[model samples]
Target: MAETPAADVHPPYLYPDYKSTRLRAPAQPLVRVAPSPLDTAGPTFPKHFVKDSEADLTTWGKSAPLGEKMVLVGRVLDEDGRPVRRSLVEVWQANASGKYPHPVDDHEAPLDPNFLGKGQVLTDDKGRYRIVTVKPGAYPWQNHAFGWRPAHIHFSLFGNAYAQRLITQMFFPGDPLLAIDPIFQSVPEAGRRLLIADLDLEHGVEGVALGYRFDMVLRGPRATPMGV
Candidate 1:
């Protein structure tokens, strides 16, 4: 994709490890957009940021079983490993019964009028975005004979309109189905972790406090030579 110029556009927040990292915004958006933005992600194209916001998606019904509660926490960074503050991140997931809120979810769960089963995160300078939500139930897909999809979440990360965007999902570890799923295996092994993050294992993270850590990576400008 053609590179956009950084102008009035806003960036997202950057983050680091357990240790603290800088939380600063750029003078403007680093990329110049076209008519708008690249939009979504698939196997064919690479996105500026790789994400899986679905981990936090849990509707009232037609999906997974409802529990005490849950939370989704993650970070957003650029190719250079910096936060892209002011960027928008969206995620959606099924309810405890494995059904979605929309009519498309023909599963068994009921619709959660209170719970949208979705959320948005605007990054800070440190690239961190967090949400409090419930764990979603496993749903059905056309992947196998029985066609049961592994427990997963869907994510949509946005950069400056014209720049590269991403749409991807995340799956929990130890899921037996990933071994046979073609799409999960499509991502390069090195980049796979970019989508699937580790679970936060604090004392009170489950029951009413399940903690999920998801990170995203967005494409940034080409490295400018020092002389320039």
Candidate 2:
């Protein structure tokens, strides 16, 4: 496994201390076994985990959610810059009001009955995927004094199977709260910009919604930082 720098982690004092003291040194690398016939064929995965690639989160319920509609489009690529087709990409986020559709989220913001804030899609032959969803709102957190989380979406990419996975978060470009958000700040300064998606007018449909492009490189020097 790749080792993330210790400085890139959230400060121990900001979060719970119980797990902080239990941290240990990195484990030794294990000896590799030669690939068998099954390993040589690579991972065989099921298709259409969430039905199709035209997933629209805002229209999940009886009506569309009240918020700014946005279109997210991106491609998944390997370290060598080749497209990774047939991969599964999943995402979830808080509603436009900064409230989650879960019991544990006790934020005072009102929930959107129409918005479930979850979507999934399978990449095409060209490794491209698209989603239509509302922009999530920033919310407060207890990680620091006057702490506030930036509007973002959680992404889980499955390259081949359960063992080959990369989890991360996507933030909007030019978010002022990112500087103070401990989770976003946990990433090293050099690679932190990779997490922010760029505005893409070319892929965006005029008048309907704005668009953001967030291409991901699974591994390499340009690889996006994965969640630990």
Candidate 3:
């Protein structure tokens, strides 16, 4: 994991405390990602990056206080390697405590009335999407006291034409929880590697400009499977 400077304890935007362990950055370059292997068709992904990217509801942020600036950037594609134009990508994170910003969360974390902990964006023809949101903090659960969630962002994406939606979470390179989190450990080791994202140390994104590439392939109809 690359080393990231410590962000102040922002009330609404909670980030986990990194113990400063050196983790190696991902080996693959920040290139577009491939679609889920389940999509045997190997068709081109849609291309509508930024074409229809917008928040269906700004209230998702809930007017919680904001830092000087914040944004999340990533790409989405399909089985055929085409961009899923205007595909809606929804995300929700805890209010700094790994607890959701919703009032129903029994956890005692403070909720940023304006920070709804949710946001949306659309993928471009290039199969990419970007969102401006505060960094989420890691919080504890009955699972573990030091059980902080690896600093991460949740991503929910709708595949072509709203047929089916894929929901997954993106984790920072070195939050220290990926090794112990049961949820993170659930996926097969081969697929588990997909969720790990690369840090944008050079893109010069204003705040935490994290980069991720997730291409969804909703297995549909009989299709020839690719021989791996």
Candidate 4:
């Protein structure tokens, strides 16, 4: 049995700064359960299930979604520094106006009729994935008086089995709100930097869109912090 690494790169479940965590974090120690054969052997997604076009969120609508268009590209790697090929990567984000299309989002910003704000793609043989999307906008939240969330994109990744799922968020470079946002502050200072993507001019399509790179390490001392 391999020992689980210390969750030094992950955020605490009960980070007081993130007020909601206080109400939901387990008060008791988590119980451990051995995985059954079923838990470790299934839940695979077929490549055809996710069409290549599904990876581009900006093209889904009848017309271009309004916002700064950008491309996000990166690789998914395991703790051993090897690619986790063909993994499923899903992303969701608020529209350019900082409003989600869901009914629960009461933010006054107008939703983009051309942008559903969600997309998914399977990593290639080298664990590389790409997404074309508009840069999300900052939105007001009730976490604190005059609170607002920084622009960010939510990411969900799944390994060969359901047990290998991980969820996190990606932010852009030099976002001012990041310093004051409680959710972003929950992670340790060292791990916090991993959540921010880097601007990569080489990946940018000339005059088409800017490019950002955000790689995710599944686990290890250098693992990217899990948002949840």
Candidate 5:
């Protein structure tokens, strides 16, 4: 009996326009614990812990890494839409001028000595999953005076252990900074179009790259809005 999240779908741990969720949300009132046995069975994930060039974040350093080159397929359903096969996704972004090779990200753009954005994959038997990065720019956060942060891409999804993880962020479809992105408006405009991401010209790749399609849905009423 665990499937009742279709009101706002999800998002509101205390979203006061996402000012760090007002100091990291959760101000008392959430204490349920009862899952052990290693959280329902061990942490399986072998088959060489992902490596096939690590799902291609544009060849991971040493060349090819500038901007505007996409291709992010999807799929990992389960809410009866089936298909949640291998699992384990993971991603990360911000590079193409929005910076973030991390050190705390000073911003001020410019940082792509081959773009070490991030990547990882695994999910076949039909649950799909593809990547190949580039296209991330849009950053400037203080969360108030001209705050910006749209072009996202930060999913995480893992299952069959580690307490069945899940995280989200995928935006990028017309992105006018997603109308003043307060963490994507704290996601509730009807699940905010399920975190946008749908261009898919057959999943592009004729002149090099251009697909989008971001499907996730791990829960009820079409869930897919958990960017934390």
Candidate 6:
């Protein structure tokens, strides 16, 4: 009989901690539960929903979501540099007003009745996906005396299986708040560049929406530093 090998752990410096010196890192589950029959033989990769691959944050209701219209596009690739096709990608972000459409958000900004601030899309055969949304505004936080979070969008990706899922936040390239935001600083400086989306007019529609390209590499030497 052969023994099992140890798992590869993520780099610690990349993840943020409220009190890293005192608090211990997350512990891996004791048992590796095998996928159940339902999970192993699920319907399709992603079950069809009312809006499975709709990435436009605007146009949910009678009017479009407010703010600067921009296009977000990216490719999903595995550690081996192979594309992960048909992966489900989901994104949630604050409106241009820097407020979410949730009760927990106490920001003074007014919410757009038409903007739900959530969307989902699937990667195509080339491992590419795109979404159209407004640039989220920076919001104040209570972390410090005058804490504020940089404009960012939360992203979730699911590969062929749930175990291959990945989650991260995408930031704009020139956000001034990046220097002061502790959450953005959590990632090691070397890996921080991977989180910022770049401006790419090539991917944008002519005079329609500005384009930002954010590629994600799941695991390995080029893995995007995931938030703790």
Report the candidate with higher lDDT, 1 versus 4: 4
Please provide, for model 5 over 135-174, each residue's C-alpha lDDT reduced to its tens digit, 9 standing for 90 to 100.
Answer: 8898898879988888798898875444457798888888
Each prediction's total of clashing residue pairs, residues at least 3 apart in sequence or on different chains, is 46, 0, 29, 0, 0, 0
Give me the candidate number with maximum lDDT.
Answer: 4
Stretch of 10 with least lDDT, candidate 4: 219-228
Give the best candidate by TM-score.
4
Candidate 4: misplaced stretches above 4 Å? Answer: 1-5, 33-39, 220-228
Task: Give model 5's TM-score versus the native structure.
Answer: 0.33
- The models' CA-based lDDT, in order, is 0.57, 0.74, 0.53, 0.84, 0.77, 0.75
For candidate 3, the TM-score is 0.61
Q: What is residue 96's positional error in candidate 6, in angstroms? A: 0.1
TM-scores of the models, in the order given: 0.64, 0.79, 0.61, 0.90, 0.33, 0.79
| RMSD (Cα, Å) of model 6 | 6.3
lDDT for residue 46 in candidate 3, whole number 0-100: 46
lDDT of 1 by residue, 60-129 (tens): 3465445446666777776666666656777777755566778666776575655666776666567687
**lDDT string, candidate 3, 34-139, tens digits:** 4454443232334543233244223344354543234456666555555556566777776554557565666666766666666666666666766655556777
- Over the stretch 110-191, how does candidate 2's per-residue lDDT look in tens digits? 9999998988888889889899998999998765567788999999887643334678899999999988776676566766
Worst lDDT run of 10 residues, candidate 3, spans: 6-15
Tens digit per residue, CA lDDT, model 6, 55-117 = 777778688777888999999987677787777888999999999989899999989888888
Off by over 4 Å in 2: 1-44, 161-163, 220-228
RMSD of 2: 5.6
